[model samples]
Target chain A: MAYELQYYPGATSVAENRRKHMSGKVEKLRDISDEDLTLVLGHRAPGSDYPSTHPPLAEMGEPECSMRELVEPTPGAKAGDRIRYVQFADSMYNAPATPYFRSYNAAICFRGVDPGTLSGRQVVEARERDMEEVAKFQIETEMTCPALAGLRGATVHGHSLRLPEDGVMFDMLDRCRKEGDVIIMHKDQVGRPIDKKVNLGKPMSEEEAAKRTTIYRVDNVSFRDDPEVIEWVHRVFDQRTKYGFKPE
Target chain B: MVNSSDTNSSDTSFLQLEVSPSRLLKPETAQALLNEIVELEGIIRLFVHGPGLPQTVPYGPAKGEPVHHPANTLIEVGGQTMELAVYVGGIRLEVADADVKEQVREVCERVLPVPFEFREGHFIPTRQTVTDYAKRGPGADPVMIGMTDPKGKLKDHPVCILKSESKGND
Candidate 1:
């Protein structure tokens, strides 16, 4: 008999969103060009070659190990691409992905990934090309809300602050802003002004955001409303506590 | 600190109106509200507070560059010019009596499109602090003790006194 896999426990919409993101089942809503993605990332130029940290694996060679023979090297690894990162600052006001969920999505869905979650922001680091692919998935899927999340490498305040009068997330760097109804990135993640304005589609309406958000808030779908999730949390805690007390 | 006996005998209370859809208030909305409230009797002072807008991109790769925000501009209020730095988070009204407070509430309800939570409390310091002396010098007016800007030069007055014909009517 084969065992089936489960992502998360809950009956609410938020929990469902969590399951979808973790399983990589989310629908891609927009297609930002490779050039535009690279522009906002600001790691390297749009058409520039990825800088290498070391000689390619084909040239440097490898040690004789069974594990190394079985596992295939990723394209970035084969090319000896330098490790780079993309970070997101998600708003506390029902942003599509919170810090923990972002890390979970990255860890479960991608290969050669290193994800770190902080209080207000989440970071995913990988070899340059791999990182760009992951960043595109995050930006295009239901994982990101253009108005509620920002691509920020530094000075990432305003996650907990109220949204500005324009209904866009507060960004001190002003890396992205609304042009009419469309949200455009006129600056890179680090606040360096860019020559071209990358158009990120129109922001989600408040109603749509609430429906798609993975966060459980009392104002939206409360966590307490999901009995299965609560029970699972308690069960996990109880097992950890009991196991810590004595090992059989 | 201003001596408790320094201020006039009028009972002063702060009426704080916290607006919803809290971010992104238009300057026109603020202007309309101010024009209405400033004409009401028994109102001693008006102050607007919210997130501060820095003149430059204070940090990161674009440090020292000008920050262009639509909300950060000069607004015309009651025929007086007022510079708005932050998105108007809330408006604080210092009223002399219950009658004036009621009038202010009515004005807010009529002017503001979004719902607001009305609170009565001491939102600002009534007395002077050591920082005031350091910033405003020794000859600072007692009435303006707590009103001076902390970042402004010693010679700069925090609050501008607008001379309008409506001032005498109030």
Candidate 2:
């Protein structure tokens, strides 16, 4: 008999959010057009054919490998598309998604992805078309809040900094700005100006963000508040410390 | 533009007005808050603090591109026009005494509708440090002590001197 897979061990909403995110069952909050997402990504121009690194897998004539036959290639891998990346910086101020959570979500949900998580930013790299689909899904889903999360290819500052008066995360490049109720991205992720502004839907309210956040903050649902999470964390810490050193 | 002569005033008490971390102050709001506080008695020095908004992209692929941040603009504060290089999140004030601190707190209460932290402590340096000595030299202006980075250019960190019940603009 197969055992049930529990993503996280906690009774708090923060843990629940983490589990939901890791399970890839998050709600879709907005519908950003593919064209707008592509423009902001800046990896390729809108409606342009994806530049390929090599011939399609079907045409390349692969060797007789059991592993290659067993594993199905992603659409991008099949097409031999160039590798591209999409990076996100989520604010520390009760953002819906955190860097580690974003990486975990990508690893669990996406196929053939290279997800990297830092203290403040998360980057996921895949073939061009696959990366686009991943970026669009993450941007349109509840995991992202326009004001608190930013698409930054470089100079990903302001994740831990205070929000500006406009209630938007500070970007040194000034890629996105708050326009009344919604946030608009006029510059691409790398700070290059796009032809037209992309309208990221309205940001979530502060109260809603707090409720949906996966972070464990003292003011909110802290780590200490969840005993099960604490126990699991201690077990992991103990295992890593005790068995990390093995004589060669 | 603060000079050593202006440091003669005996405003020893220090207080910091920190706005809520969730939001920074807009230029207009910062101006209003500064204007209100400058008019109050006992304030000798005021320093605005927050993350900087660089004029140009400091690094990365688009390094020379203009930032053009809305917060990085000129604002009129205490009858003087100066550039606000950062998003205003906190203000450090050197006042005369406890009574003046109260008055300043009252002014801040009136000016800022959002929740703020009014802290009375040594938030500003009372004397120049070694960095100041190395950068500004022996005859460094006492009034401008500890307010800026020693290695940075003086023009980048302009100090506005607003005398109580006076018309001079420094």
DockQ of each candidate relative to the true complex = 0.44, 0.60
For B7-86, candidate 1 gives per-residue lDDT tens digits of 42233343433333355467778778878887777676667776676667777666787767667789886576878877
Model 2 residue B113 lDDT score: 56
Candidate 2: where are CA atoms >4 Å away?
Answer: A1-3, A245-248, B1-22, B164-170
A6-109, model 1: which lDDT tens digit per residue?
Answer: 99999999999999888889988888999999999998999999999999999997999899899998888989999999999999889999999889999998
Native-to-model Cα distance after best TM-score fit, residue B5 in candidate 2, in Å: 16
Docking class of 1: acceptable
Per lDDT, the best of the predicted structures is: 2
Can you write out model 2's per-residue Cα lDDT over B71-162, one digit (the tens) per residue?
89998876778899888888886776678778877887788757777776666665666566667776665666767755678877766676
Candidate 2 per-residue lDDT over residues A73-162, each given as its tens digit: 999999999999999999999999998889888899989899998999999999988888888888999899999999999889899987
Off by over 4 Å in 1: A241-248, B1-21, B137-139, B145-158, B163-170
The fnat score for candidate 1 comes to 0.49
Q: DockQ for candidate 1, please give it.
A: 0.44
